[model samples]
Target: MKKSMTMMLLLLVAMFCNAQMQDPVKFTAQLKTGNTAEGEIVFSGKIQKGWHVYSTNLGSDGPIEASFHVDKKDGVELVGKLTPRGKEISEMDPMFGMKLRYFEHSVQFVQKVKFTKPTYSIKCYLEFGACNEEMCMPPTQVELNKQGKSPAVDGEAAKEEEAKEEAVAITDTAAVAVTDSAAAAAPAALDTAEVKKLWTPVIDELNDYDQPVSNSLFYIFLAGIVGGLVALFTPCVWPIIPMTVSFFLKRNKSRKKAIREAIIYGVSIVVIYVALGLVVSMLFGASALNALSTNAVFNIAFCLMLVVFAASFFGAFEITLPSSWSNKMDQKSEETSGLLSIFLMAFTLSLVSFSCTGPIIGFLLVAVASEGSIVAPTIGMLGFAIALAVPFALFAMFPTLLKSAPKSGGWMNVLKVTLGFVELAFALKFLSVADLAYGWHILDRETFLALWIALFTLLGLYLLGLFNFPHDDEGRRTNVPQFFLALASLAFAFYMIPGLWGAPLKAVSAFAPPMNTQDFNLYKNEVHPRFTDYEAGMAAARLEGKPVMVDFTGFGCVNCRKMEAAVWTDAKVADLLNQKYVLISLFVDDKTPLPEQIEVTDTDGSKRTLRTVGDKWSYLQRYKFGSNTQPMYILIDNEGKPLTGSRSYDEDISEYMDFLNAGLDAYANR
Candidate 1:
């Protein structure tokens, strides 16, 4: 018993020693009120130990983040900015390599506060977590009221006190606790305060970011299969199946010879597609890949192109070049060396089916390019081309299978129309990105849902043979392929309907607006309750002395989607979001207008009213950051100071957490 007691005491002492082992960090924050009745807050964090803090480059799902809010009034605007002083550390995780910001000895995070009224004192809370090289502690929120005793001596001191209070209010226990029995019964609520206090600084550190790549690879592979299936229905590829089989049979005179030629043909197709991907990668380099994925201009262009492609698919007009171009290629193809003939044949088919294949190709390119890497687009295109080319190769291996393939007829046209609807539906996504970048309120959450509903409803009707365009046959029963795809489409449409009334479509959570933006939602509880509107968010920030994270994201932004699907799902990332940050999703494509009286001039000297949510956010993004990309996250200190060029998130969630933790650390010490 004596020995056991000695060991226990030693362990407790060691733990306490570890907790107190951290080097003292210095933090300073200031608050100021302006003529316009707004608030500005600033914070600077200084660390004595070699340990460094991260910048305000918070990810969707990451650690405890730095934030500020004003608890004194309503409609008081607060913005924030973080300046990081440190060296960058590069680390590789399973997903990607990323650079983290840290300091060895000392650094500072500054916060500025502003208000319409010249208030000199603020009562707020400061929340933070501490860690050494080996161990970490839970987060803690310090409730303190800061006031300069001699406001008349140094005006700056008064301002500084106010700012400190505003910064501290970020983690203030001022919120009225929900009294519902459900809140008490819920598992997450049991340790809410303790979790919030302990997790704040270490929020970014406690994450299971070690998911294997096999799942990601599998998802891509599955997408490839889906693309292949979609391609098989196109008129250009569908007719060729029968034609190739008959040609092989006639030329070979024997099954063996026919199979050999078919095999060669398939090999040529794969080579051609892969080469195309490589060539594109080589041409664009890394910068192009980055832009392809997130460039606002590119997204808008792609969106418009899809509209045109969809129109063609709907038989409004054929997007075809002169037949002479194909004839010339054919002649040249025949003259080329032996294997090149197969490539030429593949090229010929692509040209003949340009109208049918163009939209799919464009969609694939857009999806890949949004991953913000040079190799992403190339790999995506390779996947798509390979999927498309496989059928040709497979048919060559078993010409008999071609006999059972669906014949071309009215169903083909119906398929084209169906694809058109899909193309049109996806087009809005690009537009949404551009809208958000430019603040064009052309499509909000409600508007987007409404459009999707109409598009899918039409698709269901077309599938059931109740609706027909001039290009579609008026008489035809839905075939097996049509039946299945139509059913899937119909089911998807029905699924989205509930989302309009506030359903958490977790399966496609990555594809929709955040649950916060929905006016009506069913599954939301107190922990992650639905945000009523932008006004409510703004009002809360004014009242609580908390700064907001204006997330410039879009429904169709592929990178935005990828980040949601891949990065935010990490448990660490989710925890931070639920506890640390006040998330404000501003869809750039929302088509609502500010009052005409509220029209304002932008940095580019353009005058316009806030006609759309996208327009306002887009203008702010461009003028403020010179960037027009989806998944653009901006962290402002309570006084609206933009923390530009901080440590940001990419594919790696740890790095993202590093940014969040660093920002919070800076705020805590301040």
Candidate 2:
């Protein structure tokens, strides 16, 4: 137990502490002459323990693959491409949710180039991503050349001798991984001083980041409040509203004392949630929260947990904590005299209501964590607790109100069963994210749609008294609420039927599989990007005297598809984008090979090789715009300067329009 605690503490520190940039691989460059004029530049890297560099050609959705850059492309003619020689390790990695090819230990990268003269000068470098189990470092570069005369002809013997001594899998880090997740941006390399000569710091041109201010924290707090309000109506909580009234009313029949105690009870609930928030803060900072949503393992775990919670709601089994735990808290509440006693009572309430509350809490945490805020968990819980406490206080002040409240009975069970169906629906969405990330293709558009259709259709039938679960009343007729819900459910199910044939079910597009996943998408009204290349798009935007909407997206990105289907499809939005702006849709995960490799120097003078179309766009987002996530939309002027702040994956049409209009206003003003 001590060891477990120590390990957990270490993990927490490693995850929560602000980490400094550290380079895991050190590279040494040597020039070998196969007769002075023609030979290879051998770059060797000594990889630190627990870190590995990814190999070339690993898909874009995975870690940034190893590649080389010939900085002085015109200075020397290339004999062939750079080659990695090592014991390459290939495996499925849950971190990035893709198959990865990486080299561990020490790996060697070889670049063969031909010199125009007997004595020549050239420069080149290697780039790769270095990652271990806990975290990933940003893309790192190591210089492989220093301009000078080619060395004399005796290199084969020296090269062979060094090759025998230095052989292991090695590369370095690439800006953690394009996730930039609910994946945190990889830590930058600390060896800034070492690569100073070859690197140029890039910040001078990137106008001070004017990202649109976000009110997401307020929203998260509101969501928590809403969740707490919903919990009060659950089977486990609703029946207690009047019981609380009875207990407070019986307290010496003293209205003043009872109201004070009830107020203390509300404070206790806030304290409990605030304490929970503190624990989350200590364990998970912003980046860790990001990982909770983006990391495949976390998502999969959440998916499975939600499924189990859904089953519990459906009466498959009850979810409960140890009875002793709650009993102990109850005992403490009774034994104590003041605030501690009230707090203990609230704790008991929380424990007792875990079944109904747990699922709702899970949903809230997942949503907020995806937003990647360090304080989200605590703030969210605070909001939830406040909502839960409001009724308790109200009932205490006037104990008669809850006396007329509907009792918990078959109605509560109906509500629980209905929530079960909704939970089941959400479970599939989580599972679908893992499927897309892993390229499993198990839950394609049609498959996902079919499953949802079936689930909702059954839900409608159940609501209409066509069937029942174990806990539900055997023959209860459809009530007003259930009948209306059934109408909505059946209508929703039928609405999705058209989606199977590719009707672009914009209503559920944010939740459904992307149209590209559908084998048969017959929907016709679509907005096509004028250009996929950033530079070309910007150039055209300049020629057309139009502002640009740079859409940093990915093929595997669900939110990207959601925006395209939902927000972008709005008639006004489509018209504005089509007429007012030049749209550049850069797919960060596009694996299409570029015509030829392009070597781009990063601001830090570190070299990056854009080997594929995706690499180029991904690099542009990372370096130029200072972003890496997909479904990122930024409005920029013809000069490549952002007209306003960038917009990400919020599907609020009016807000999105406001964003566009703001950009246009900025453009016109400029």
Candidate 3:
């Protein structure tokens, strides 16, 4: 009996050891060239079929980003940013509250270097993490040789090499063939339909639900049409219409040919604008454009650009294209004959009217790029081109319409000044994006609201003829349209005044900072008492003999915030949460580091090291519940077993109240 027990104990120990050893990812590094003077180091990974690794440039609150660190050496100098080579797969990760890019199957990151010494070795290590559908491995570091060659002999080096070799031998020798029974027990891969469902964009993922891609495109097109109509009243474009049409009418002996050439000119304008959009889309792919929309640096740059354009529109300085270029195009129009001449004239007109049209076009591109769809910019340009072209075509078709058209006067200048105020107001929103992303407290919710209020109030006053700039006419009386616009502007300013307090300005919620940022508040937004730590929350639940509600949330999570404001605030839901359950709101995007390092081996036998608070909660959510999404609400008794099914983002009060009640009933029955 003793001998049999010993043998069984040995077998159990062997199984345990086998379970503890796993290497889902294998990394290899090599020099691009043999010469040591100037070369590139290429780091590549062969990820397991089911796993993926993140890119280096992930968002601030994302998963551990893959990175490389080279120990400082005497003669080696690092160069530009590490460039990743592969098709980067992007998805809106609820944990990060942003789109995350990752790679699967194979991945490569290349870094350039310059070496002055003839023979020098560089010591380097890489840090990365891998995750499958079920679980994630902690960030791992592997030391590699600079030259991608075997390490030189030293006492310490030899000992390390021996240990590594032993580990490798164990892994190789311990490999066991799986039996048919074991293979059958393993989980199946996701089918095509399941994969497709995972990739589908949810309504909550969209930034603008009402104005999704199609609606956004249509609205942008309408804005372009309105802009084109506004441009027709401007000094530069309005005067040229009559001159260009009359020139074609007088120069061409055949009226039919003149009409044909006029239509051609319109078509050329459309082609030029559409080509511009195509070039933009080609130069910057959809991913890049989307990234730029949320990137802090890009937002700052865009804000500055808008400020400059606004100043120019306010008549601080004209934003004309090079006079020489326009002059050259004008000369070409005079020299060429037939269709070519008409096209050149249209090109010249575009260049000459840059001061007026440039701001409008710049604003449109900025707006469309923020939408982050590949086709949005092209569609917007198409609409603007159509609007601009229609007027030229229609005027050519009926030359007599030009006679009854309204003349350009002070109203054009008023339009320009009004647009400047609007530009200035929008510019603050871009600046706010940078501020929020970087946590730069320069522009808070109150500050942004105050600035917008001031700008709009001034705009109303200006429209009422209360103030005049250098370019304004001496008239003090406001016209009927101007009076109405002024009234609307003042009304808008007044509407925002309530937002200074803790009122949720749902209308401007997208542009404004979150309500949590407001310092002084008459109304608080939080529905129930909460704890950020999971263990603490569980302990409290046990002490109170109540169930726990784990809320996986994030600061950047829009839908998470929306649910809190819309559903959790319902009277029934709030009462149950506050009275019955212990709520643990774990922000998966929280950047706070853990006071003490904690590491554990997952059930899959992969070692996971938790470095931050977010890492801890994120792992718990994924590992325990097999989910990585948020505002994920899971109810469990003190033992951490589920009382009811998990609840995700939903605004319906009735459904949410039912979910809470179900959890309560389940807990009571248990």
Candidate 4:
């Protein structure tokens, strides 16, 4: 229950953080004119601190430059390019491989125009990209309007008219304050009910919300096929293949009729399993199942359930549905006539095999449900049913094939035992999730790795016939498959031993807890780049006469870890980063709170408070570079000018080397 509450709290915190990181720039525009037909128009931008707006004349290689357009009027003529009037920061952007100009804090742009008529009105708009230190938003446009009249001819009156014009311009600009008015009218307080609604984190199904349903279905279907194949080797379902096919042959003497009935039986199995999937989907909606995936209570329950299943496979106890259900179906199979009887017989097989297939099916369902797809369960069941039914149908069609099949015996139990070990190992992953979310520190990286190593080692010994379980035969010789599996298991167990000392085991990195969770480490003394504060890194780069490599990373970023393990570990890339550049890794997902909270009005005029270190870095990314994606690598010179094109999550070492060398060359030449 405590873990469950922790999970809910974590999700709510994530949602709140996401909401606060939105719309980093605000804009307002006005027409500045004196008592003349000619006047200048100014566009003012009030950007969030740490965020930046691109200059109108930024190069094509960088982000989209800020630009403006004035609607053509009968007498109004636009005279010069929009000129930025503020502190324009110039830097060579590594992401774009060119120099770019941008503004932080606030900026105003002026455009001179002439009106032929005494009175004129003009409509205009400006387009610009707003970025912070971490990420970039898409370019957006803000519209503006100006209405004016010619000044009086008298000198004193003209001066008064100019004053009036200035006052009217200020009022007109204030009228166009799109952000301020909406912010003012917004509810000052949110009700508890409304807060509850906001607390629900909106999971984007898979990683991409735009992913097609068919793609998800296809992947789950493949998973089902793999599961069915594993289930086929288990003791419960394998032995029945011959017995069921013989019954079909005995009932129908005619070959053609027997084949047709066998196909019907296979189709029946498919329908039954698919129907079961449909029933599950109907009982708990997809959204609920998706939520269950991250629910701490559900994960704990699932972990316990898997433990029970692993014990069952290890011959501790059997998990079975009520005998009445299978008995009723068996009676119907015997009483019903022809096609209906065959279908009932298939249903009976499913029920009788439930003890073994049930665990596998249940495990599969739990895995698929987490994907948040409506049809994934059905598709998965369809695939599993198809794989299970194929052998039964084929053997019935050709009884000769049954004789060629290996006899089911002690080897089947070995397969079960191996799977039992696997299940026990995977159960730890769920526990680790709860541990990480709650900061319980119960199952740290070394402890989890130790448990897995022990489990696989025991499994390998059992496979080699060194130990006997209740179900294992006393004097059976190890078969070829068994020998190889045992060897593989032992090898895998040995491979994980190094991970205890902080080796980034790339293969199992996804399953293991993060490296930082480890209490002890031997690999910490390597000559890696320093991941210090951003300002300090820039200062170091300037003092040392070297470039700076800014790594926009996240603690929770899987790809970032992968890149560190794979590409950055390469000798050349590592050398360049450690020796030639001052590196600073800014973690966008860091949850550490700031010393004091700072509130800023967002681009939409909505208020956002930066209370955490991550929030600050996220704002920095969006404010400076206009990008939010992680594993973003940028190289800059002492003057804070970018040295080369930026790199993202590519694992190709050659490409990374090139990126590093290009930056080094650019810095040297500069």
Candidate 5:
């Protein structure tokens, strides 16, 4: 009962965190001309059911005054009085002691501006507060453009309006010009242009949100083909050919009967694997796809599982079932179980080749799940199983090719060793996740690169027959495949050498530390070129006097790719960010170092250097929040108050606007 209760509670919490609960708020803007020929800007906030927006007219006590600032343009002037549409009365707020006046459903403010020309345009930054009866969010800013045209009065009225326009224009022009200049000048202190430009990849990420679901499905098919090809080379399926052909020949009196049974074997293999996939899809709802990709716990667990599989590949142990299990399955085959016999045979094959296939299956599961679909694993597995099963059936029908198969001795051992290197290399990915989540600086760029170099160096030595393992072949003959694999491993090691010095390494940019996060970066060495660090980024937030966006990401995280490709690309989301946000992206896998003097004693009380950019940010992630996963978006006030309940992503794009708006709402209220 206790276990059940715990499971239920966990399920409920997961549901709440992943909930699509928030509704969007609407606000309207209108433009009008004053006698000055410049436009008078009137902004209105329209709240939905159970929502409220605060008034700007409080005596320095209300939520930050519904403020507006005009971008400076020559000859355009804005002189406006902003008054809230609702009644004014003082109410106490928890954070601020000032008595505040607020509108429950909506509020509108009008500001007056002046223009020297008959027509002019102005961009206004309208910052305001919003709340419901229960909670107030942080303050938010909305950018709006208001345009105006002069009235067309022919005779007597034209001169009078023209005189009024000139008078208002003279008074408003100076104030607008000064405010605009200051706003433009502030970004220079921290390299605003360079930072915003570096963030162009965000636009590409946003575009992914709108991509068709079919494209992902196509990728699933491609992965299936790759899995099938890989299965063809494994020892388990390759050796099965002669045994199957000889068995069919012995059982059937005629050649045609033997061919018919072989076809049934292949058909049975495809059917069993596809059915297994469908069952997996049914058992785990598609919604789990999101959590599987972005949840920190899930990523860590998966990484550990891969490590275990890697050890198995390295010949530490074999994964196998009981001998009686295969005996029982084989007995069913002799009982003429037909399709069931074929499935039993496939199951037997899986068990027989457990050592070789285990690592492959684990790798496939992680890869497909990272695609952000519940069906991904099932599809990947089905593809792989079918591939493994097909060759047996094919070789049964054509017995002559068995003569050409490579005679097994040291060759299989070499293949196993090659796969061992790949398994170990891939295991680092999960460790990267744990490092990002736990704030371990040990896995930073230089450290990660150095480890890969050593791992590959050892692998190269092993391949050249200089280093012999317990299972290695005693004979010395380097085949072309072995030579090629060794060369590739060595070349890859060479490739990573320059990354220690902060090279861009653009060819594998997605997998390497972002250039901005490198400490001694060589390629693009401009200082403060863009939003490189959290302190300067927070400073930008302070200047805007708005909420801050903390984006926790990593170089090795796969789900980060899916989120960037799918959810961040939506047009509504794009507009919201371009207009309202101060975006800060912190790569948790970055290897850049921190200042030598700055250090924090972790919960375990170990003395550790803040060696890498990822280390510091990842530490912040864990200390601030319990989990460390990439594609974590935390919205907070400049004072670091949490907004929008913290968000993570996997597949759903529509919820992105909700997450953004929720943060904006929180800010507007705070």
Candidate 6:
């Protein structure tokens, strides 16, 4: 109970820190009118003290480099790249693991655009990355869209209306521009201070309410501990514990020396694992981990690796190092003395247990590598090693405890087989990632669920002795623990049955394919994205006098699917989205080809071809909204004014209801 409370306290602290989160850098865009047909979009970024923005020319393998994109349209042409108009420092960035240029305090970037037509519209957006001592913010977008219109076509009518407006302006006597009777109701005008605040972008206000990214290190450490605990019960590690404990008791002259040496042995284990983590970090680093995890080729490779490990667990093969390595370590331990000997003994144990512990270590490292921080891998290793060493420490303090320990038996094989099934389940996650990345329809939501249902059901049957694997003892009777585990497996399979026809199944949403992937969805309260085009959705909302809700999502977004399964399924959220607002979903990862190839000036001014519908919508998202992260949500009125703040991947039901309700109130008040 005390441990549980400590865990809860840590969680609450994390939540509170997230609630008070603030960005260290802020950027705004303004259209400076230089001439009738051309103007420069000036992007000014105010970076807080100690925070810096990367320069515009870092290579692809480095941190996010600032750049601009001028979307291709008729009658508009980009003059040049986004030229930096501020002082820059050329130095090394630790997070980037390379030498590069960056700007501190503040910077200004400008892009020149020309309009051929007298009256025309054009869209442009800029992208950049920022970091401080601790954390690096995700790549952010800033939209700098501007347009021009021809002067009044009828001079007489314009003059008459202008004269009448001037008469009303005299009567009002206030400095505020009064065009109608509505302004006459107010007696006072805004002061200079208030006027300065009026031009702040609505997108910034929306972004101020974005959900915090919860990539907590504590949570990753907890995952490592859980993996280590599972490894403790495996055949190789469990049987060895008794012998290890007896050796320590018999070897030392006193209990104090024995305890000290055991402690050193445990430290050796932690050092070894942490060294491995450091090696991994040095090889690829945290900056590359995110891309490696999301890349389709990488996912395919990881999936195949897991499958091979699972095959070994199922007794198809044995994965082990040469016997000579362990024998050499044992021989060294006998020849050496003191701490070095004990360390060598621990090393021998690791080599001997490779067949069982290797897969767990691989999974743990893979899981932490995607967390986007250099320290994460080391922290994960520390947690796993500590958990693995706790039993060794306890045996030194109480040497006789191993006499009551469970002996190695077929039960350990049961644990091994259970882990094999789990590995198979996780392999699907990698496959799902690959499929979504490449737009393959083979692993749709229903199909993924069907496969899982069959797999888990077979596991349950095997646990109940209905079947046997290659190394299973013939006709062994099921024990109480095995029976309960089988029951759980079968129950989980039953739970997934409803997911075939579109039940949310929030439990498995993180692993299953998205609901949109399913061809049929009969969930009664489902809220659909009726408009895929942004302009059409806003136009419809204007006609109906309802506010617009735009869902910025991606085909590969796991959190988006989780939100649909968990939060959107709630009755209040569904009702608000379905009845009160026009819903538009913009998928940034859509793969359908566009009508023609268009040249793109990337963030670094490198030219690339934008040839897909996904590219078009992704360009629009950054060009108009100034955000690339998903699932991003924003509410706007018919006149294209923001109704409320933006939201991200958070699953708090009450908070979401308040978000929707606030938009409704703001729209009505507007």
Best by lDDT: 2
State each model's C-alpha RMSD to the native. 19.2, 10.3, 16.0, 17.2, 20.3, 13.8
Off by over 4 Å in 5: 1-215, 513-519, 525-670
Clash counts for the predictions, in order: 87, 23, 0, 24, 27, 1
Root mean square deviation (Cα) for candidate 6 = 13.8
Query: Arrange candidates by lDDT, highest first: which order?
Result: 2, 6, 4, 3, 5, 1
Candidate 2: tens digits of C-alpha lDDT, residues 1-670: 0000010011110011111235578777776655455767787878887567778877667665777776574346788777889999776543345677788888987888775643456666676666554344445556655444443433454345334533222333233222211012111322233222112213233345454445566666777787788788998988777776577668647789989998888888888877877687678877687776656678788788878988998999989899999999999989997778878988999899898988888777776676556787888899899999988998898777776877777978887787778777767777876777677788988899999999999999999999889988777888898899899889889988988887766556556655667778776667889988765676577678999988877655545665676677666788899999999898775667766666655545455566666766666566555555556777877666766656665666667788899989989999
- Reference-based lDDT, each prediction: 0.51, 0.69, 0.67, 0.67, 0.55, 0.68
lDDT per residue for candidate 4 within 622-669, as digits (tens), equals 544444556677776765556665566544455567778988898889
TM of each candidate vs. truth: 0.51, 0.71, 0.59, 0.58, 0.51, 0.61
What number of backbone clashes does candidate 2 have, counting pairs of residues 3 or more apart or in separate chains? 23
Q: Residue 94: error of model 6 in Å?
A: 35
Q: Pairs clashing in candidate 3?
A: none
Q: Candidate 6 residues 505-576, lDDT tens each?
A: 755654677677778888888778989866567657767889998887765444566577667986778989
Model 2 regions lying over 4 Å from their true place:
1-54, 57-65, 69-98, 102-120, 127-144, 147-210, 531-546, 550-574, 584-633, 636-642, 648-655, 664-670
TM-score of 3: 0.59
Model 3 per-residue lDDT tens digits across residues 1-670: 0000010011100000000223567766655543234566677777777568788878556675777776456556778877788878876553344677889998887887776554456766566656643234544554445432222223344334334432111010011122232223222443334322322222222212122112446655666566666666777888888888888788789888778888898898888878887888888867677666667788898899889988987889999989999999999999998778888888898899889988878877777775556886787788778888877888888999999988877888888888888888778888987886667667878889999889989999999999987688787579999999899889888888988986665445546665656777676545855788776666567778999888887665555765676556545677888988999898765657666545555544544445567756665555555556556777777766776666665444555677789889988999
Query: 293-382 in candidate 1: lDDT tens per residue?
Result: 445688788888889988988889988768998898778777885667766877777777676766676666665554434665456555
Of 1 and 2, the candidate ahead on TM-score is 2
lDDT of 5 by residue, 1-670 (tens): 0000010011111111221222224555555543334445666666664445667665443343576666545456656577567544345432242445666655677776666655455656565555442222223344455333444223234344434542111000000111121123234544544333322223222222332223445445556656566555656556666777788778889978877787787766677667656665667555564455445577678767767765665667776668888787777777766667766776666666666666676666665555445676677767676676666667777777677766556666666666666666656655654555444444666677778788887787778777766666676677787787678778878988988886544333334332333456554422111364665676778788767677776543334544553345444555566567777777665545544423444444433233446655654555454344455676666655566565665344344666778889878987
Error of 2 at 18 (Å): 21
